[model samples]
Target: MVDRKLFAGHAVRRMRRRAGLTQAAMAEALGVSASYLNLIERNQRPLTAGLMLRLAEVYDFDARTLSAGEPGGGADAIRRRLADPIFADLEIDRAELEEWLSGAPGGAEAFARAYDRGGAGTAASDAPDPGTVVRREIERWRNHFADLDTAAEGLADELRQQAGDLFGAMAERLRVKHQLSIRILPLEVLPDVRVRLDLHARQLQLSETLDPPSRVFALARQLALLEARGEIDALVRGGAFTDRAAERLYRRHLTGYYAAAVMMPYARFLRACEATGYDLELIRRRFGASAEQVAHRLTTLSRVGARGLPFLMLRTDRAGQVSKRFAGASGSPLVEGPGLCPLLDTFAVFQRPDERIVQLVELEDGSRWFTSSRCVGPAGGWSGAVRARFAVTLGLAAEAAGVLAAARGLDLTGGATPIGAGCRACTRADCPQRSAPPAGRTLLLNDRETGVSPFGFAGD
Candidate 1:
């Protein structure tokens, strides 16, 4: 018999938590009741191989993680070991007993508890890569600025008036410093003339197909990196680093941040933003920037002492893939790392081209943010393809005041919904897509009926 007693419950619990499924949610997906799932999770029920396999399939966990025992201790040992933890009142002694319990639920829970408190910070170098850490750092800054947009507005106004030609001068340097070149061909030439980089020569060449306005932006992004490499490095130097791959990822991430900052140049952009009453379109026109570029730059207002209204900015295609995300005030709430917000109805907007303003949704642990979204694309001239297929939104807490409420326009606080990535850190009970219950909640069922959401918000 395989000793599958080592922390089977612990492993299951962890996987369930990470998957963001509540016991009821998991039970619904697994075709079982919440109580049965709770039994398996609490080490009260010995997990059968068939049931174990089912869990692995349903939750996307590796089979090895599901059957937790000492190295090579088969499934039975995993079960027995986990069951041993609840047998504290029982008394038995054997050489194998110690080995069996060593890898059991009690031990696994201890390790997890330690790790949660930051005691176990190291992971082996060969661990599978989680690609979003560096990306999340960028999102965090975007959120910071979004939260402070009002304050940053005052600063942006001052900088815009004062820093006339600084960006132009930087563009001039790109022409002189590296013999950089720009061209403007028809849109048909996009396939070949888009942009190319010659890393060895330290030169960036852009397609002649882009209009003069966009061409300037391409040039500016490249030049911005070259000019601000030092500042970029200084910012990412102290991050939680694991390997060279992470460092390089972070460096490229910083390049985009610097590029956006240079274009707006902080103080000037904030001043213009405020004077224009946070008019995103006006800023784009004045700066000759694309809507996406303008929104991105707007989110970077967190730098220096100035801040913006602190909004979350996301650009997604009709398909749910997120092309860009900027966090201006709060850090990204995603614990598993940043990706598309499932609730953001970007595709629907593409269907209704005339709806310039619509509400975007996000639900997490019961807190909902009602956001306004609009589409953007190249404006006028060079007709052939409709280049505008992007949406932009200004999100604020449904209950917030001033610009926040102004963006929503009507009072939407009545049923302020809950939306978020998941329960990894979510506190909402009314989320329909909730896959897991709140962290630390006991798996046992309570009498209260869960509302419409898959995971009912856990009562305080």
Candidate 2:
């Protein structure tokens, strides 16, 4: 419950409810305060070893499950329940939904059962897209988990002690531990597989198609997954994953986080970032990391005490679809939900894959920001490799843009574009890129004529 600690509060709450006991009764039975019991039920308080031992005596179940604490299996059922279009407009957190499901899983199931029985309105076409639901669940988090930081930092420190002073030493340490024989196969040999491990031969095969940073990254990622199993389990328990997909995403994310931390050990990375004025290329050279990796590592600078400038880093394709987004320390939601405005610099970088686009932009509310977008690339779309047009947009509030090395000569005298997070919820009706009118607004299509803009609103 305390970021990285292990406990399964869901199991306790479920068992107690099954026994048909009140909170006060359960609290007294557990020898804790009713409020404390509530915390335990909600997973806000950990089910300590002592508590697990006591629960064994109180109930006739093995206490070992509490060590890792079984995560409630209501994710899929609750997901099915939320699939009803009636819940479409609601911005519900899966964590909170999971809590509700755990506390009253029977009720949750009954509600879903009733909904399936046509309590929800007809027309399956009206249901939210399953893909959209998944994205929303992922977007609920700010994309940084502190527990990964703790785990990654611990792994990096251990490697640092063992490997001494060497760049990309984590990979070396893993090679020794796993008794791995590194092999770089032809691009055509393992076309889809970037990194493949053979348990029998202790051979690690990598596609030569990958660049240096990517190859190292794949190795480090594999190492993280293999070695950080316990940490990953704890992170997963703490992840509150609503489905297997979310859990998989979290695992990959954790592995990537650990990989980056190993590649750029926090202490050295932070100092280098400061010394280099946060120059991505310079730091990339100093540390064997890619531009995307460097940008991502920048966002994870949220470690306590030795923190760096909080920069919001987000990735998007030419279609304005968000792949990864971080809110930074300012707590300002730089971008929300999905469907970025076509006018944003991120999408624009797709045109000139060779160039990095930097601009000063103003929001509708008049807040200004300095943003830079660069294609994280295979240059010419490479035909066989990663897309060259996929760009990562990194930005900082105008007030805090000094952290950027390029901000020294950044011109702020220009006008900024009128942009919106997305078109459906966007209030701006005077744009040519308007695919549809704002959700609640009415078009001024009367007896007269249409306005100059593609989508015209009733109000000015």
Candidate 3:
């Protein structure tokens, strides 16, 4: 009889809200008194295992969320980062900052990005923004969502026990508890969609063209959403999103995380990562996930005590627009300051799609990074007629490169390309591809003297 002593209070409230239930309504669904649910939400009383399961059985929630713990994200993480003297004048609290983070994570991240770059404002358009803050919130304690991974693994176990029909098991759960019917539609009307839920019709529609892994993942995501809705909602509502667009964007991000986790259960996936030395192709084939998905999931493997390699992920388009980024690793993390470094092979791979490009990048301050960059075209079942394309770069600190299989045969020594966030902050005096002079630097020009570098700063 595990009491909800470990229950996430905010999460319970959020689940109730997402279900559009009153305290009385939610309590009734959970087979508990309205006062008891009220107490649970207020941390005045803990829910028993019976009530927890009842909530899940009724609402399709993953039970792991109940044990994930309390939410106080923005206050502590933001405070530590802002401890610098530059922001000593401002005072922020757990409740106040949490409210702000919930409502406008992008703005909060914009502030953190500016601070991380030691700048007055965000100079690079693609640098960490409020949207990033929203996504990073879940990523910060990614293991909390590892419960979804465990649930996925549980379903996998059930498949073995029931002899290989997890979808049937899941569909039966939907039908019995949720009164929902499942349909696999052809890619004609669903050409651009992945999963469509018709709550009014109590129907779930998925694309027939979805690969086996994707089809299972879509089913898992739907189940995870129903069972884990409270978990996702709690994380989303805790940020207190003021902007509807940012809220919806982050909600989708959280949902996709559940989908990926369900597809590649964390523990099972970690075993594969170790056996494969974090090789993207092998992991993709083994899990039936895409290379891009495998790469993105690599960044989320930082669960405590069960941590894997500290790999950070970044993706950018041909036009130099950074679409996705995660810098969860600690040591010399991928900084967010300037525009695209024209010299880094990360951008060049756009032309050489199939080629594997490895890089040794050194900053002006002498820290180094090891990275493998490759161009990945959009996968099938993406709504558009023409799938989009982007280059994904997986990188690690230079000292930590020893843990990665991709770093083999490469000179871990010198001859590294000296790069900066962009021309605005770059101090390199001799670069052929300087886009703009570094900020606060006076462009050096003498009538008789011409330097090879387009705009050599006076200091440089």
Candidate 4:
């Protein structure tokens, strides 16, 4: 087999510009001629192993940065975006996409942004969904904010929480520092509201209906708004959100992240995670947090140098409507798009309420994931009214299953249920649970014979 050449011209040029080095200066540092360096920077020449070693030695460069434009990275994102049905007629090949991504990454990113904004020709009245924009931004960062984690760790230390009584500590801090009194009002008084902050009265009112863990989360959210406002605002401003609604929504999300970080405090939580083998129930009890909160926090353990398992989380209601999703470092396509495979245990857990379901499933591409799903809260309220209940699923790559308690004593290789991203993106012809036909395929209507799948399509 021949060795593949490394061509990261854009990254090399960016690094040089960021270092404020002239072509000749950088070339001399890398022990290469200026003309050769220029050729490498222009993609006319590929960087050899020796040059790459020199780059690492001189600039402390990470070789993996060169793979950003490769198939499974940024180029993959462009490919997935172009896979949308709207671009079906374009028939843009991989070679063209790789060339575009390497040649003008900014233009490629702009194209992605346009696609995210519901296409370039979207009318003024047809504003892009604010929630979609915020979700994309969160996914772009892989739901991890290092600065927020640091600030929250500091705040958690300052709180001096004892026996994991974070709610009490936070309430005391609000009373002492912010001059905000905490009051638990009866459900009859605050029937519909769970938390109400009266600025004029200098009081934070929480409904008695909220469970202990939820109460702590609510208090932490309030404290985050008061204490981490600057950090949250900085993150929101950095988002460059054109829609004020999206900006506000993103601000709320950042505050929630900060709140979780404060409650779980990165170092302590990571230690607990490692020690417990990521047992969600045990960790929730230890931290005085809800199952959903624990699962969500698991996704945010993406700190540099000291990272935990790269987990992806998804929360959905009985109707299969997804309410929350975080892709984390794993970047599973299952968490992306509107559709989810009905066959995944995420939906099956709803059948067995309050019980944790662990399943090893293989996607269409043969990638396997170990998933744990359980039903989360529907906070107490008037008995006559409807309450919301959701199932939360936390999953990681199956290769790392050995590290998780949930995957213990399970067959990792065999007995893996074959799954797909969703009905539209899936090509599983024999899947009986398919709710819709795969996209870009002609429906096969056989009057005489019926297949296992209700909607048979003509394809491979």
Candidate 5:
């Protein structure tokens, strides 16, 4: 297969500017002519693999940034936004949109921002939903924070040297460094909460109902708060959240990320994944983490040259409500929203809770992904309370399926299940699992015909 030439002139320019280098200086450093570098930066020439290597060697650039796709409101986002019925009459071609994005990305971003604001007439005070803002921020960074990972890895190393077990080490660190004692109380004592830090008592309280893995996670999160506060605060500040709620939510997420890193540790985890052919069960046992925790850690292995396959993850309850999603490097729209296709294996895994479901699915954009999902957690935990079950899914581009143990013995090509981003944005008119018609298409109703799909719509 031939490789696609990368046309990331905007990214190249951004890298140069961030390094405080002029075009001529950057070109000299890259061992290229000024004219050639100028063309490359102007999108007139594609960024070659050799030049990309030079950029990495000289300036310590991360090639994964280009693979993360366009930043924020770039071409892909603008195209998806244009799919709305409001722009149906425009008939914009894909190539034309790409050209426009490459030439004037700022203009494209402005248009996307305007559309997101419900057009230019909407009030400026109408801030975006805080959750949306936080999710976007996470996606902007591809759900990988290098500084946090580094800090957590260092702490993990120190903890390992201090004690044999991670949890014990984390607890001891908290007790010694922060004057905080660890206390596990019964669920009845802390009915609604799972973990809490009592500043006045100088104790970290955890509910006894939590399993061993969860207790370790709780301890690690507190350790993150005590040891990695500077790193977490820096990341939250860098997010520039306009809403206090979003900032707080993002900080919590950062701390959780740190805890996961401290538990798994980047270099060791990546080595284990590669050795195990990306086996989740084995890795989970090795790290003493739960299935969901192992999956979440897989998404954060985006550390420059030692990067793992870029996977996206989604968590959904039995009711089909998506609670969490991380886009990683895939940047596929399927994981970006709650309204995902019902035909996905993530929903199917609920039927056979004990088994993991792995399938090759093709999206409407002609991209194929290898997905594996399994049911996790009975949040009530045998207490006879409301038992909420959720499915956790991890997916990456199909090309990398061979590296995954779950995809073993499966055909990578052909026989892929055709799926959509969601019912609203999905253009698949014949999918029986579609709950609603696509947004921009006209609904077709005929008394003489009763098709497989509940709602039929006109094709684009």
Candidate 6:
């Protein structure tokens, strides 16, 4: 049937297939019977407005494609379908529908899917924050990297002598076996450039857009992908990819870990970090990485036998916007999920440049962990746009405190602040910024007993 209404149905079918969901499952999510939802997909029924909003709310689907004419390449059939009873009295324009479809996939798909599923009168929900999405993506990669470490550890002896220069060795292997040329160019001339792997001439061109340190880093990344294909495959095969988009994200993430491993050379970096007592600045200078980069690399030292303490690394701007986070050995369960401890004065360190070190204790699930935080400035010209208060933090469990190199001087056990995940999830009843009560706590607002803390939760 040349039903214009079926256009959105087709999109839903495509997305559902990509998401690996069966029709009955999608129907349940839409609050409709499987047969009814199937009819809408088959263009037997017009999708109402309510159903559109529900789709957006549930699957995080784009809503723009709902009102667009018949889905797919059959434009003429869609136009005929649009002219049916559904649009006979309505003043809908096909051109407008096409324009909306071409631009807003997220909004459209949400609307059509929602309407087809019998959405209530509720309004569509807000799109999720991109920062949150990116953070979650990073956490997934961190786990994937851990797997790579395990595999590499098993292959250590076979690759021992070649470990330090594995990238170089891999590149040479590729060149000798595949007849490829590797060249590095300067950063100023090729800013934002990266390695280009050419299959035609079998050449891998490294971007000159980086310094000598970075040139070698990029080469190593290329070599990792080429030489360690089996390792990479093992890491990726465990993931359930719904679409080409997610697969592409996995590949890009893999390339990044490879690049980091190339520059840091896991074994060498770990030894240096141990010898130097984990000095952030010293490591940054030696590895030609930014302060944030250094902290990130430090957390990844858990490759094979040289596992670092499960340290949680976070970098935030003066405004408390977290730029990056890495979960080391501590495996702080909070790494992948939402909610941050607002009282964890990591952000304040940026306010005072000379005051390099500050410590606080956070209580998660009744267990206390000591966290050390500091702000570091960016290298290069002072006039650069980099913020002054870029804070980085390292935390160690109270019980496992002595193992850390830095925690050696501090008291093994001490009194500390009882912090919670962000203000909403925090049980601290005295916090002024507590907009919403915590998940399972009663806020007692006694004028005489109210403390200075923003939210004051009675101590258990």
RMSD versus native structure for model 3? 11.7
Distance (Å) between predicted and true CA of 83, model 4? Answer: 5.1
Q: Name the TM-score of candidate 6.
A: 0.55
lDDT of 4 by residue, 107-185 (tens): 8768767766666688856746888778767765667787789898998998874434677788888888899999999
Estimate every model's Cα lDDT from 0 to 1.
Answer: 0.52, 0.65, 0.67, 0.80, 0.80, 0.56
The candidates, ranked best first by lDDT, are 5, 4, 3, 2, 6, 1
Per-residue error (Å), model 4, residue 36: 13
- Displacement of residue 70 (Cα, Å) in model 5 is 5.9
Which candidate leads the pack in lDDT? Answer: 5
What digit string (tens of lDDT, one per residue) describes model 5 on residues 114-227? Answer: 554444565656645666667766765778888889898998999899989988888888888889999998878888887888999999998878888899999988888877
Q: What lDDT tens digits, residue by residue, belong to model 2 across residues 226-281?
A: 87778777766754444466567667776787888877877788899888887888
TM per candidate comes to: 0.55, 0.67, 0.68, 0.85, 0.88, 0.55
Worst 10-residue stretch by lDDT in candidate 5? Answer: 67-76
Error of 3 at 225 (Å): 1.4
Summing lDDT over every window of 10 consecutive residues in candidate 1, give the lowest-scoring window.
68-77
Clashing pairs in 2: none
Better of 1 and 4 by TM-score: 4
Model 1: residues with Cα > 4 Å off, grouped in runs: 1-130, 139-171, 183-193, 198-203, 211-213, 303-305, 331-344, 353-355, 360-368, 376-394, 399-401, 404-408, 420-460
Candidate 1's displacement at residue 170, Å, is: 4.4
lDDT of 3: 0.67
Candidate 5 stretches with Cα past 4 Å from truth are 1-8, 14-25, 43-70, 73-94, 108-127, 378-382
